[model samples]
Target: MNVIHAENIIAGELNEFEQAIRLLKRLHECKARQYLDSWCKRGEAGVYHNVMRKLDRMGNIYQPYADHETEITDWFPLVDCIADTAVYNLKWLGRMGQWHPEALASLTAYVCEQERLQAKEK
Candidate 1:
């Protein structure tokens, strides 16, 4: 009976730990999205006939999708640009060096370690 009670305590702790991990990951995901959105905002140009021509020099800066935004008047055109930007930023961030699983694992480990350290502080 004592062993069973201990096991249940462990299981409950694990569940709580898992929930904390998920919440941290969700917040990180939201932060990453906001980062991408900020980058995308830089692409948005006013509707002008010479906008693309003027923004042509922006290609030298190696941004995510400035070219797409030069002419984007609606949401449909942005889909491909955002996808490309995500891939570009992922590569730029060194995430391409490791696959998705490894990236996720590293993020998870970082979050877990931070949580552990933070809990120790309080």
Candidate 2:
């Protein structure tokens, strides 16, 4: 199975889809270029893949869909973990909302990492 890394796919940052598009442009520089390229053509088989293909063709810059905020929340590592739960619970909560719980949690974890990096800042 081909799994896209969160960082590679979205970086778990950039609340704006447009900014996410810009971030994608820099992914080519990642060490996993070959791995990513292998699946670029396979996106046609699925909706997500198709969107990815569209993004790829659009050159790493795209505006979010009008419903992006209501659909996909900011991705974070922790939130990513529980995102599915949050998404599922939305209906139970009687509110059609997008809450990336795991992603948010992961983002917090990432923040901790960033703090560590900052400690070594020169």
Candidate 3:
């Protein structure tokens, strides 16, 4: 468990909601550090070219990384897309009203199990 989880656990226990939230937070931290953050340091134009190469058909959405100095311009849509993606997740919480407790318990357990498997692989 990370500091986030350790700080939240009280008397060897955490409420389902808090546990699930912390688990997802941990998952995000892992992905951002191991994968997402490295995208900008890879390939020809780095993150820009890597993503645009795959999104060529969409003329409006994709732009070639011509000027490496202004790479931040190419990364702008990513921030916009993140906000859109965050809003899209509202449906899940909206649907899990009455089943939140058990659902969160399962979510936390599933994340912990996956982390264990991933760590063992490493």
Candidate 4:
């Protein structure tokens, strides 16, 4: 998914951290589906398992944010974790020529914009 789609999901009305996670989850699902389709078409279904594993790893990184006790004060650290995982996932996808550069760029831009906006509130 692109930044516009992410923005639409966020609707600029929720907590910034929550919105960011939601967008990331959506993008992860989209990327997973893209990889699945590409691998299937190539008759390399075995490789799809690797993609799922990476996605699962990303999900593990997101677990803390999924916890109800996570505070707003934890936003930056959580975002950093997500950024790291996303970069790792993108790099592997790139090696396989399955990466969506535009989507990655858009998501990065959106995250930066959110960070800026949230900083202004403090």
Residue lDDT tens for model 3, 1-122? 33333554563476666665555565556665666545445432453454454344333343344434334456547433442333224323433444366886787789999999999999
User: Can you write out model 1's per-residue Cα lDDT over 45-84, one digit (the tens) per residue?
Assistant: 3212123433443343334446554543554334334334
For candidate 1, the TM-score is: 0.24
Q: For candidate 1, what is the lDDT?
A: 0.46
Among the numbered candidates, top lDDT falls to 4
Give the poorly placed runs of model 1, Cα more than 4 Å off: 1-72, 83-105
Model 4: residues with Cα > 4 Å off, grouped in runs: 1-65, 98-122
- For candidate 2, what is the lDDT? 0.42
In candidate 2, stretches whose alpha carbon ends up further than 4 angstroms from where it belongs are 1-17, 28-32, 40-43, 46-75, 78-122
Model 1 residue 88 CA deviation (Å) reads 9.6
Cα miss at 16, model 1 (Å)?
A: 24
Question: Residue 92 in model 2: shift from native, Å?
Answer: 33
| Model 3 misplacement above 4 A | 1-85, 88-99
lDDT of 2 by residue, 3-38 (tens): 334544554444555443344444434523545444
lDDT of 4 by residue, 56-93 (tens): 76566566667865535645554555554664444454
Write down the TM-score of every candidate. Answer: 0.24, 0.21, 0.27, 0.29
lDDT values, one for every candidate: 0.46, 0.42, 0.50, 0.58
